[model samples]
Target: MDDDALRAWSVSVRYPGQPEPALADVSLSIGPQALTVALGPSGCGKTTLLNVLAGFVPPSQGRVTLAGAPITGPGADRAVVFQHDALLPWLDVRDNVAFALELQGVGRRERHARAEALLAEVGLAHAARQPVWTLSGGMRQRVGIARALASPSRALLMDEPFGALDAFTREQMQTLLLEVWRHSGRRIFLITHDIEEALFLATELVLMSPGPGRIVERIEPGFSRRWLAGEPVRALKSDPAFIALREHLLDTLARHRQANDKETA
Candidate 1:
């Protein structure tokens, strides 16, 4: 799977009657083991770029490919976890995670075992028999993550998966997600408006700008690796290097916003 990479070349999206493209000349390559995060403000086409990558939205120009093949539409190769938990309300946590495996023709006993293991991985083992509606928001999102992982996909796509959670829950979820990523070693393309979240989770961070949304910067931060290497989360986050990079990103975002406002004015 060395050649298994998702690539977009000069991709642009234009909606009917829209004066500017939502995304313009955006090119990115997500390898088989990358945790890529796209960070930008609203209207910056972060979601647009993600949708295009997920094959939910087609680019008006250029093309997207996975392993050198053109992406025509959504496929089983990419599993998406939405901002809101997309769990089936009537299904129990175990069944919800096993649903995709069942659809793929896996036997009942095997699928159940796989689902149970995934639930445990996401800290939802105790909730396996619980009804979806009975789970808290964070629990529901854990179920969502488990479901996405149950797919035989090469890449996991997430759009603000923790955006709806409270601060404490969100941070907990981020830590859990990194643990999952470390274990799975699957490629990930995640979109988010949270700067700190992006910095914490991304192996490669892609910063985007509005006015026909395009990438402005690409950074590789070592915090995630440090966390994986037995560094405490709080200690790593409070490290001087981390704080400096965080402040720099904040300044860059401020400048982007000011430039956008002036353009509109």
Candidate 2:
């Protein structure tokens, strides 16, 4: 195991009174340069694994660590962005992003300046003074990303961050996220039920199964790095290799669902 990577070693999670574990013997490593994504159906424990990594939940077995340190509770080393933008409605864009810095006792001038730079990076500098509630879903999410960047987090952990947006807006956010990942250089660990989104954004994609959930497959699609290399998003997604892998993954998911149904029956 690489000491510098965020890792889950033989992790398992079983909720109280539950007959089956949410996750079983799952292991994964997220290195600095990889965009690690966990893709699965609703019961496949994607969020469970993410919560373990976030230190929001403890593993029933084994351990989760970041750069050799055990993750016992939530810490500043990881920032989470959720499906809905968890912005402070009262604080305008800039203030919301600066909120983290405020908690750390950053000076008024310094925090706002840092927040402004982050907003510009997300292409939202002009909206810094706008109320968060007045902004559209996608705009608010951009602010959320800016806020995450404001923290001194080493990794960005997102849970279905684009799931609430319309198709067009989701696509736009996907591109923006890739750009942010490139510039910020932070390790990304995102979970999603959207297959196409997973295929497009993951450098390392983990396919998970649901009966006492566990990893079924893992692959490095390399599409994200291609986008960073200046390839057009549409062209990359539509490539024959991309389409074939998408279909293969879809079939794998369907088979898992069938097996689970049979077990219940």
Candidate 3:
């Protein structure tokens, strides 16, 4: 892991002909070994901010940088995991995980070895030869995550990565992601609408509001460290403190929505 910090400086984005910016003056830092989650409702620029961080969409104003280098476009240094698993149907699990390495001209044996190790890390070693269509939704996401890790990326950027999974499966994936984060110690920036999930997974949580999306609040919830320190997931989530914080965040989001609606009206 490179431990390079990813940063956004007064970033803003506006689609052509759009009356307002999709993201306005959004600034944040994704430090090495920290899990930063962007939490917001639809059209709040969470995805837009993630895209800017991933270099998928260029900011109309301001800039994003990794270790002081400008993020002009997507690079292997920042791997992205989308809400949907975009695996190659024709390829088996191992090959799919190694696909990026192959593109980088890594030799077959080396890439395969690395892919197999990553599969084992994500608990998919047994499914190495299985085709993509054969895996369940959660299994497929594990493969996606394995693939992302196989990259030499300094940061992993995820956009609603668990949005497609059922509640139970999403929770399982969240636990698995935390384990991976603990083991890998790589920087992560994830966007999500799930309040509890954000609170549970984020070392730092950012709340955003729409109508030229801007951040409303930033919270540091230490639940992830507690989980890593051997606390059970269920217990952590059910803790009184956790419940109280969740309710507070929900109320905050509702208030923001009401204010935004009034301003637009």
Best by TM-score: 2
Which digits, one per residue and each the tens of the lDDT, describe model 3 over residues 146-180?
A: 99998898899999999989999999999899988
lDDT tens digits by residue: candidate 1, 118-198: 999999889999989898899999999999999998889999999989989998998999999989888899988888888
**Compared to the true structure, candidate 2 yields what TM-score?**
0.98
Task: Score residue 57 of candidate 1 by CA lDDT.
Answer: 97
Expressed as tens digits, the lDDT of each residue in 1-265 for candidate 2 is 5668999999999999999999999999999877999999888899999999999999999999999889999989999998777899899999999999998899999999999999999999999999888898889889999999999999999999988899999999999999999999999999999999999999999999998999999999999989889999999989999999999999998998898899999
Residue 116 error, candidate 1, Å = 0.6
Candidate 3: where is the Cα deviation over 4 Å?
A: 1-3
Q: After superposition, how far is residue 251 of candidate 1 from its true place, in Å?
A: 0.9
Top lDDT hit: 2
TM-score, every prediction:
0.97, 0.98, 0.97
Model 1 spans with C-alpha error above 4 angstroms: none
The models' CA-based lDDT, in order, is: 0.91, 0.93, 0.92
Clashing pairs in 1: none
